[model samples]
Target chain A: MNANSKTENRALASTVLELDVNNHAGVMSHVVGMFSRRAYNVEGIVCMPVGYEKNGLKSSGETSSEISRIWLLVNEDARLEQMIKQIEKLEDVLSLRRHGAEHEVFERLEEFFH
Target chain B: MAANSISNQKEMFMTSKRSEILTGAQIVVRLLERQGVRLLSGIPGGAILPIYDALSQSTQIHHVLARHEQGAGFIAQGIARASGEVAVCMASSGPGATNLLTAIADAKLDSIPLVAITGQVPKSMIGTDAFQEVDTYGLTIPITKHNFLVGSAEELLEVIPHAFRLAASGRPGPVLVDIPKDVQNQSIEVSDWPAPGASDPAPAPDAVLISRAAAMINGAARPILYLGGGVVHSGASGSAVALAEKAGLPSVMTLMALGAMPVDHPLSLGMLGMHGARCTNLALDECDLLIAVGARFDDRATGKVAAFCSQAKIIHIDIDPSELDKIKTAHVGIAGDVKAVLGQLVPQVEAILRKPWLARVADLKATHPLRMPGIDDPRMPYGLIRAVADCLDDEATISTDVGQHQMWVAQAYPLRRPRQWLTSGGLGTMGFGLPAAIGAALAEPQRTVVCFTGDGSILMNVQEFATAAEEVANVKVVLMNNASLGLVFQQQTMFYGERIFASKFRGMPDFIKVAEGFGWQTLDLDNAGDPSSALRAALSLPGPVLIHASIDRHEQVLPMVAPGAANKDMIGG
Candidate 1:
């Protein structure tokens, strides 16, 4: 059985959905609102624009990597699989990757903060 | 200082070819008219004055001045729900934008297509928290389908179309656009307006999954087709019935899908879940296969998720890919449009008459008939709903507020067509009735619109009564005055050892007087010697009318499965 299979296990584990979306004003709302509307909980979220932008040197249309990377930490239930599929369908989302509980992006952040 | 940022952003973002030079407010007005927006509802303030000034010059759009921002949003929802088209509402900064939150959340929960436009403080003042300034984009982020904070006039041109497209497209919901005041004042050149993108057609169903679902249907001895709101949104009621009839399968409707299948149909299991018929819940428990079509297994519908349809080998089909296998892992998951998928699957499966299974279903239904308390007495809420249902045509749309009255309507109202029944199912929002009814009435001017509201729910958005009267909307407010938050009171009674504190309203306002104050024709059901005559007279009134119904506080929504209990473990008769 695949590790993601619901049949083999019902054990709850946290999963992260990493998404790259077009950097824009409304994109994050679409990502966050879908979860809230469905009553699904997001344990942690980290998002930031890719490439250099602190100096305001690049125009919005000119930058090739005008993309924002979003990491959503959620319980790896059957619902997460479906949520990932929906997130992929969003027009602004360019690509997505699902990481199992072993992924330590949020944990690493915690360690850095400490 | 706030105005400088808008100018700075405008200079940086003038990439589009300049064809015409006009103020940002004028562009907004022109864009709305070009997009075929005939009606809008809002209350203008200092930040939005320029837009309103431009709006006043236009003859194409009629703006309704709502008493509250929430009323405006719900009115837009009503229009969208009734018309199956995008609707718009507007508000200014701070409290005005905050007031619209409840309605926006309601729209999000029920998947209503709405676009809310809010005016913000000048861009520099956004973070500074100037007078009447609030971060509308931040506040509404969790409640909207998408939200835009327009930085410049050029951005406003792009954001408006995107807002409409996002609001109307795929599993539709509310979207918001927050415009800085200076952005609306500054002149910008625009070549042409981008048209809102049309909704993309649902992807074709997988051939392999279709066959798998067909095989499951053919093999199962007892199968049930569970339908929800997505079926209605996709206009797939005919296909839903076709599949059910072809396979000789019983069907169950959720609160949002009450009218997807006609209640009088022979194989219909009226509704399933907390307030569901006992037979329907039992049928679900016994079902060998649960073919969930456009139906998310919501907690209210599923009771305890693990025990719900435990025996069923599920075949889930939905337009939204996310809905499939979300709650219950399906044996065969087909991610496609309900209509197209049903069209593909119905022909592949052979028709079978499951005589024994259907007979058992009939027996269960007979054994646990839906009993009403004093149903013959018009004084009861149940009787009032029955009386109203009798008077209204099938074409009439019924919008309801959340509470005991909403549940009573779900149980007793024989909704005949999809889109005719509008209720806040997912969000369960109170105070949604009057404003939604106004939108519904305006959307379908020829058809009658009725709002079923409770004493507690009406108080949440009582300000909407003025809007209903001012618009002269073809709506009737059937206020079931139980003098308490009936559902909360019921829950407290059952689970909290009858400890009712905040739920009761000892000195509720006279609904008749309130309706009269709002310029509506009023009818008091309690005082009328012949209530049927009074009801008929109220229905015949030319303008907005309020039928004040006096009901007992003891009346409860029956057949309620306790929290986290199995569907079969219902408490009331």
Candidate 2:
């Protein structure tokens, strides 16, 4: 591994952020760009369309679902509060929930990466 | 029977009008008209031709054709800053879109309300390096409050209104809407017209936090009101001034909040931070409580963040929650509309005369006031600004391009009203003054607009002179010629061992001749027997005019706070 990976490995205390966002072509960029621009590294990201249901009613569209859920694994740092505040400011981010490092979402996929 | 049938037909017509087929371009124009956009600025090019063609038929909206895309963007910014309204700018793909990025970024940093609409290449042609093609949506994402890429004509209805809403909402900033050429050309039937987008009501101030903040204000011995651009953005200048007066608190304005409190007010400490008056910085240094209202602790406003207001407990109030503790952690952070918060918090606080503190501030003012070396000489920088101020009243708007001239005006000019001063504070854009002045003039035709520009800064967007002349905008371009980038030269003189590299221009353009060439009336103060009279005469002219004055390049903006230095430590004024 490179020096960067070593640095990441040293920062063992991590947090998983679950974000519900509007499904669109540019939503991913808005979500990921926030981390990249601030130089905050994302350890892993998994995203998939949840459904077209909004306000408990299915959106009538043949093209695709209206919303998606994004999971982000990032190192816990002092700037995380500020980072979350900035992300929450984006127009598409519906809600954000923080999970502890023990969350199994990233752990279950770790074997596949190896 | 005929009257009854006519009434029934009218009812049928009203119902049919609710749903109609419109091209994306038409929808965009109609939505803007509904949003009360009477005027917009842009330049037409290949990618945006469809929108332009549709806009040409608009009876309700008038488009000002700018010489450059950046000029158009700044023009929009000028309108927004001057009126505290969400303004719009349009540009084509690629270079046109790229050119607008600077102004958009400037708007973002300053929290100015602007909607930038750009044309993109057809959806299918995107990422193929087609002619005049660029990823405008991608480029603007980092700069804007929010951005949209419209996939269909149907999306235009939702996107356009949302863009306005986002631009004008709490903690206002620029928003971008990139419409593909095909999308603009596409036809779609719209059923229900969305209501014109407006700012959502600000979250109510936390009553507990408000009470705490008020208690802190009432209890503090030496409290200072720190105002920023957000004050102007929130339309809370009156409330801010009232708060200062009622509590007998000394107030200091950031560069973007120059006219929040009249500089001549007894409690007004002109500006705080780098290049601020010695008295202002000294007062801030000694302040026991820093009541920051709608003011982010910008590095310029608070030199060396760790050292800034070190003695003070901060009570920070802003509409944006993210800004509350982002810089200096506030002891009492209140996130709400400043106007509303002040409205409630004002009555709760016990009004007392802070006599000793005011006396101390007054003593500081008397001993360490802002020094203007040649304030009476019209040829000098400070004097030139003063002379111009002498000629115009508070009704005349003042804008300046970035450099030494900007600092001088900010320091010396006696601005008394909100929305009376416009400058590129956050981005420090060089070419902002002229076009912004034009936009201000266009927005409020009755007001005389004056733009103070330096030799180095004017050349950046000099092409806007033609637009000013064509529109017959009542603008006087006060060109302060120093033949060098004065700020850079000053920095090099101070820190870089006086080794000036590209800061000095080898050959200077005769700005008087250039202005004349651009169909502007020119007045050379260098040639005039009485520079003051010449300025008055030039300013009195109805159409676009240029008044030029020459200054020594060595003159510097002063009482300088060296970068990263504490505010208390300063150089000569």
Candidate 3:
């Protein structure tokens, strides 16, 4: 995957596109490919399986026991809106949430590193 | 005590009467049979031998052995795209699985439903970087709708059904299942048969949004219905025409939605965006209400995003919710199946007398009609497309490899039925035509299947020529050889100050000799003296025939809206 260009960060605000996708092997690749295919770079990505304790949670009728939440960080632009639409179209992606710069996940990570 | 009871319950479930003793390979074959698959394409190899051994005993399915796994993947895609059902492809570990990647990615981009099954090295040897072991799961992640690396035979049973469901369900795409070699040989009691993949219901459109859209349609002086690929996916072509005719709005067909409405419809603004007709783009710019259906405002479709429809109030209708405000924010967004939403919304929209708007559209058409070079020259790409389209059936499935030839087919082919024009619009995959044409022919044996290809694109999978002949597919190959990557050459000439790079080939193999070598009857258009007589003979051939039409490299696809330029500002008009 190509690293996000530094020039994209020169904007005043960056938005984090948080997606809830089915916990399957290819979900992350599809999401990243959608962005890269359009030349839209994702600066930061954090993806993990939601639950490991309960492997037999099949009574709810869900196919997989785990789900993945991926946060994509990028500077906001007019193209970002369209990118989100394409991302939301992914079959594995269940839901999406948009976070402004005020979202603490990235800020906290910066502080912890310091 | 609790742990003991849990183990006891699990043992009981495993030994139930409904269970049958079967090898892992038998389970795989049985699952595919249950999914209603009748045909498959693949090559046999070491890792997948167990499954093939089991497959030999099954009479329910027929497997067409393709020369390459990539060809097999495309054969499956052809079936899926033609039948609107899940198609299956199989391969072994390592290179066999890797070769299938291109077709899988092609299916993903085109939204064709396919399930690719592959054999993996033993589970224990997976991460040690064992011989013939590749990270199949890791490598396939981005290209598939979903993928599974089954840990056991029991998991295999669970994953197969879901894999079919994911591939065939909402926004259909390719899915993959990689099973280890040992798992295929393992025998187990079938404890239970899992339920078939669940069917997803088309989402109901929000009533309020529909009403708002109807109001916009009723109030607007100038409106245009922009159709996209989703319309074909949803089988909403009838609804698309109904909405347009009822509201009396001009409709601009996107590249993917070419046949959604008849090409001759009075209000039809023939293909819109980059290589779109100047009249269509002008009508789009002037419209006050832009009703976008099943189409994303892709960069190719929207020349300059900011100025695409500056004066228009957008109403985006799509099954995929994210597409609602993805490009141009919809003034009224309907997130539901295009057919269902349009079904309800069409009746609510008041009919209008948009005489002035229609007149403006007509005027644009009269003033700046799409012009083709060498209308009388049969050697030209556009002229060849027209000649072939005339010779084929209206319901014929036409697939094209990516390049200048693809754009010409999109522009000139007289498409009469929805889902009849298949091309790599999203990812623009070269080498897609021959394999896809094979797939299409296999799916609908009665319909004529034609593949329009370029020299550069066809060479990408030129070996598939054998697969076409081997399958005895009724596919005709119209090889338009420019001896160079024509699209790239055009781009370089127009944009990059004409510093020609490696786009041209000095010592290319003679395509006719290669086609004949592949056991296909070859015809050189230049040698025939009369193009029409040669085309007639080629089209009437029994099996796969190649019509090699060589043209000058300088010929370019015209009416190009340059990147970042407004739709109205076009060169080569």
Q: Indicate whether candidate 2 or candidate 3 has the larger TM-score.
A: 2
- Name the best candidate (by DockQ): 2
- For model 3, the superposed segments whose C-alpha errors exceed 4 Å read A1-114, B1-18
Give the winner by lDDT.
Answer: 2
> Over the stretch B228-288, how does candidate 2's per-residue lDDT look in tens digits?
9889888999999999999999999999999999999999999999999999999999989
Model 2 CA lDDT for position B155: 73
True-vs-predicted CA distance for residue B183, candidate 2, Å: 1.1
TM-scores, all models, native as reference: 0.89, 0.97, 0.87
Candidate 2 residues lying further than 4 Å off, grouped into runs, are A1-10, A55-62, B1-18
Q: Mind giving the per-residue lDDT tens digits that candidate 1 earns over B1-573?
A: 679988877766765444788888888888888779999899999888889999999999999899999899989988888888889999999998999999999888888889999999988787896999997988887778777788777776777877888787777889888888998998977788877544666668898999999999999999999998888988899999999999999999999899899987898998899999899999999999999988889999999999999999999987777777777888998888888888889998889999999999999989987777767667787788888888878999999999999999999888989999989899888988889999889878998999999999999899888888888999998999888999989999999999998999888798888889989899999899999889989988987999998888888899899989999888877
* Cα lDDT over the full model 3: 0.85
TM-score of chain A by itself in each prediction: 0.74, 0.82, 0.73
Model 3 TM-score, 2 decimals: 0.87
Give the per-residue lDDT of model 3 (tens digit) for B61-174.
988888889889988887887777889999999999999999998888777889999999987888888777888887887788778887778777778898988887767789
* Chain B TM-score of predicted candidate 3 relative to the true chain B: 0.94
Q: Note the residue pairs that clash in candidate 3.
A: A26-B141, A29-B142, A82-B326, A85-B322
Give the candidates in order of lDDT, highest first: 2, 1, 3
